[model samples]
Target: MIYNTLSGRIEEFKPLEEGVVKLYTCGPTVYDYAHIGNFRSYVAEDLLKRFLKFLGYRVIHVMNITDVDDKTIAGARAEGISLKGFTAKYEKAFFEDIETLRLDKADYYPKATEHVEDMIKIIQGLLEKGYAYEKEGSIYFRISSFPEYGKLSKIKKEELKAGIRIDADEYEKEDVRDFALWKAKKPGEPSWPAPFGEGRPGWHIECSAMSMKYLGPTIDIHARGVDNIFPHHENEIAQSEAYTGKQFVRYWFHVQHLIVNGEKMSKSKGNFYTLRDLLSMGFSPRAIRYLLLTTHYRKVLNFTFDALYQATASLKRITDFLFELETRNFSDGQTEEARNMIEKTKKDFTAALLDDLNISGAIAAIFEMIHWGNKAMEGEKLKKKDAEQIKLLFYDLDRVLAILPEKIIEELPDEIMELIKKREEARKNRDFATADAIRDELFKKGIILEDTKEGTRWKIIKT
Candidate 1:
């Protein structure tokens, strides 16, 4: 089940094609570095894709990169560079940040500039169908022609003033809101020639055209941040459905906003934080990912310094568990007791994910397993087989949560290893001062060491 914003409730998700899901998500505009608040939506969409695949569905996802929008044009003009060159800088940084967070790449990243012809085709169709009109060489979708204009947004048509229009790529009009399908070419801005004359695609029409070009006339799911629900997504439904006379998308998934230090995040508010900003402050990408996924996607996540510290500590516990399992001795046969517990955990985990992707519930189930696994280790009830089962279970859960740092830790320097060996030797020789000194040295270098009854293990502190 998934929350359908259009329907205003949780709905059972059934894909249009069996075993495959056509997912389209709104991507970054690429005018500037995306903040943590922006990433909150992307991370939630990633979780949805993972959960769908976990449930045995193949997902073909497309995310649009808005390279030719008002913001991009203004930013490029401000920098005195071509729009392509200006957006390229931030676009590169956007991908780097996503890679740092370990998000899987979408099947296609359709940029708006590359799809102007497609947008033109849709505008032509709307014009032929009498759902659009040209104003000053710019074509606008005639909302008055479509009676169900405000269904998705629930803003009645009567409330909208007729004859009013918004020329900007993004805006909210109080009257009859006839949004642009194509804007007239202006001096200094990028231009593309079409039947309607030389101009760029509007913001709302870009997603509709690109999504239909790749995913067909209808899509299985359309996911975006809650902010997109109003003029952006609602406008999408109007234009696309008006063009094809078909349901635009079956399910509309929206992730809520992120709140920092008890207020909405914004640069004007001085609470804006980019992913790199958090990383520079000593927060691990994995810990940030973990904190982002802990709350339900629909709920506002309140980010704080204390939450980051808690995420770091929680991830350390998981890594320590993995270290213990990897080094511990295990038997060949599966322990029936451990097998039963693992099976129950697997069942609960599946249930939590299937029921509207209750990630918090799924995480709770994982912590429950970890708690019991640790107890089994302490009581001698955990055999080599039991340890292997628990280890495999962790791997399965990590496939979804992706919070483990083992892959990241493998990149640590060998000097950290030599220090660990020296620390071990100092302790063996009963040289307490030398051992303490070595530990402090490693800690200063961002390496944290933990000694257990099994053995001494080390982790690279991300901060």
Candidate 2:
């Protein structure tokens, strides 16, 4: 089950088509570099997509890159470059960070600028349907025509009818209650020619047009940050459903805002941070992703340096357990109970995630598995087959968590292998001084030696 933002309750999820899911996740605006707060939502969305695929659903994910919004226009003007040219560098930076964060690539990333014709067609349809009005050179969605404008936002019609929020959106329209569908061309900003006007599509219309073009008019899932629940998403629902005469979205998933240092992150307060900022300070990207994944998306995440350090420690504990298990000597016979426990833990983890993405429950299940493995090993009851079973389960779980280290250890260099062999001999002959010297030499060469009950197993230190 997943929480439906529209219904404000947990509901069973079923796709329009069996064994298939259409997911639309709101992406970055590309006006500037995305911060950790923005990535909080992306990480949550990625987890959901991965979990869906793991459950045997073929997910067709669509993320829109909003490159032609008000922010982009102002940023382009500030940089004295063409709109696309200015946004290109930041968009490139955004994708580079996406790779660093290990987010799964969406099937389609529809940019708003490339789909003006699509937006115009939707706007024209609304106009023909009497759900919209044209004034001067601009078109606006008539809120009065669509009585269910505030369904998703829980905003009352009386509140909007009281006095419109002009500055929050375009104000050239007839009523403050109505939002812009198409804006009139301004002197410096970019514009697109339409039958209604010569201005670009409003921000809300862009999603409706692009999502319908790729997915159908009705989609299975629509996700974004909590701040978008109102105004942006609410506007999309108003225009989209009003034009199509059907439901626009089935599940509305929204991630709560992220706070930093026990307060809301702000540029003026000097608490704002981008992903590069954390990496430049020598924090691992794995740790960053782990921290973001621990908290439920519905809860506000208070990110701090101390928390990130703790995240690194937690991850190291998991990896160290795996490494020890891999290198240790085990008995010949397999433990049947251990295999059953692995299956149970896997089921528990999946159940927790399916229950509205309860990350804490899933994390507890992982630690429980680790605790069991350690207890079995301490009792000398863990067999080679049991250890292998536990490791396989973790690898499967990592497909959704993605918090473990990605590098697979490969063959060691000849010199390193020779040193390892010499160290083993030194230890066997009780040559303590030579073994210590060899270990120190290999440590300097970026290989770490862990002496297990079976033998000395060396790991390559990752920079």
Candidate 3:
């Protein structure tokens, strides 16, 4: 079951096309690097796609980069560069950041600036349908014509007085709330020619046009930040349905905002942090991903240093558990016992995900398997096959979590291997000083060693 923001109910998801999903998510504005609060939505959407693929659904994902909205133009003017040039720099950085965070690339990234013709076509269609009006060389969506304007947002048109208009893309108006679909060209700003005016698409119309261009008139799944449920997504519903007389989207999935100190994270409050900011501060990408993915998407995640530290430690424990399973001697147990445990784990994990992506529950199921593995080893009930089962279970789950470090590494340098051999000899020959010195030297070079009953193992610690 999935939570549909439009219905305000949890419903079983059945895609319009059998075994396929057309997913569209709101992308970065491209004015600057996206903050972590923005990524909270991106990462959640990434999780949704990953889980769908895990469940054997082919996903066709499209994310729209809003490169021509009010914020982008303002940023271009400040930078003194062409709008394309300015947005290009940040757009490049945005993809790099997504890769750094280990997010799966969307199948399509339709930039709004490149798709102005599509937006104009949609506006013209709305005009022909009597859903839009031309005003002062600009085109505005006549909210009164679309009687179902407030369905998604619960905003009552009756509460709004008539003869009022709002030209600003995002500014809330107290009286008139007719939003601009095509703004008139202003001095020193980018503009595109349309039948109504030579200007640009409004922020809301950009998503509608781009999403419909790629995903079609009705998207199987549409996701955004919960804060966007107001005028942004609400307007998308109005314009897209006005153009094509079908329901705009099947399911509206929204992720709640990330907060700091009980307040929404934003640049104005000096509380915003980008993915680069956290990476520069020495936090591993996997740890950051784990911390974010472990939370339920609907909950307001409180961003805190303490929580990050705990996330780091939690990931370390999973790695340590993996190491113990691989190195220890566990060759004496019944295969049926381990097989049953593995089946139960897989069942529990997938069941949690099926229930509206209950990721916290899914992860808990994984940890419970880890706990069982550790206990089985202590009781001499774990065999080599059992160990393999546990390892493979984690490998299967990592398709979604992506938290574990790879078990295999390239061969160590000859010098490093020679030193390890010498250190082993020194220990056996009662040369404690020599063994201690060799171990310290290796540690200084970022190699960490752990001795097990079977043998000694060393891993490279990225410095």
TM-score-sorted candidate list, best first: 1, 2, 3
TM-score of 3: 0.92
Instruction: Tell me each candidate's RMSD, in Å, in order.
Output: 2.6, 2.5, 2.8
Q: Which segments of candidate 3 are over 4 A away from where they belong?
A: 160-175, 329-334, 407-411, 429-445
Q: List the candidates' TM-scores in order.
A: 0.94, 0.93, 0.92
By TM-score, the better pick of 1 and 3 is: 1
Candidate 3 Cα deviation (angstroms), residue 32: 0.6
lDDT of 3 at 122: 95
**Candidate 3 lDDT (Cα, 0 to 1):** 0.86
Candidate 2 has its poorest 10 consecutive residues by lDDT at 163-172
Better of 1 and 2 by TM-score: 1
Weakest lDDT window of 10 consecutive positions for candidate 1: 167-176
- lDDT tens digits, residue span 195-218, model 2: 886998888999999999999999
Give the per-residue lDDT of model 1 (tens digit) for 1-463.
Answer: 8889988889998999999999999999999999998898989999999888877889999999999988999999999999999999999999999899888789999999999889999999999999988877788888888888788778887776655465464353222377888888998889999987888888999999999999999999999998888889989999999999999999999999999999998889998999999988877898899899888999999999899889888877878777777766655666788899899899999899898889878888888888888888777678887887787888887777777766533445787778788889989899989989998988897777777675687766652
Candidate 2 achieves a global lDDT of: 0.90
Q: Model 1 off-target regions past 4 Å?
A: 162-176, 408-422
**For this target, which candidate reaches the highest lDDT against the unseen true structure?**
2
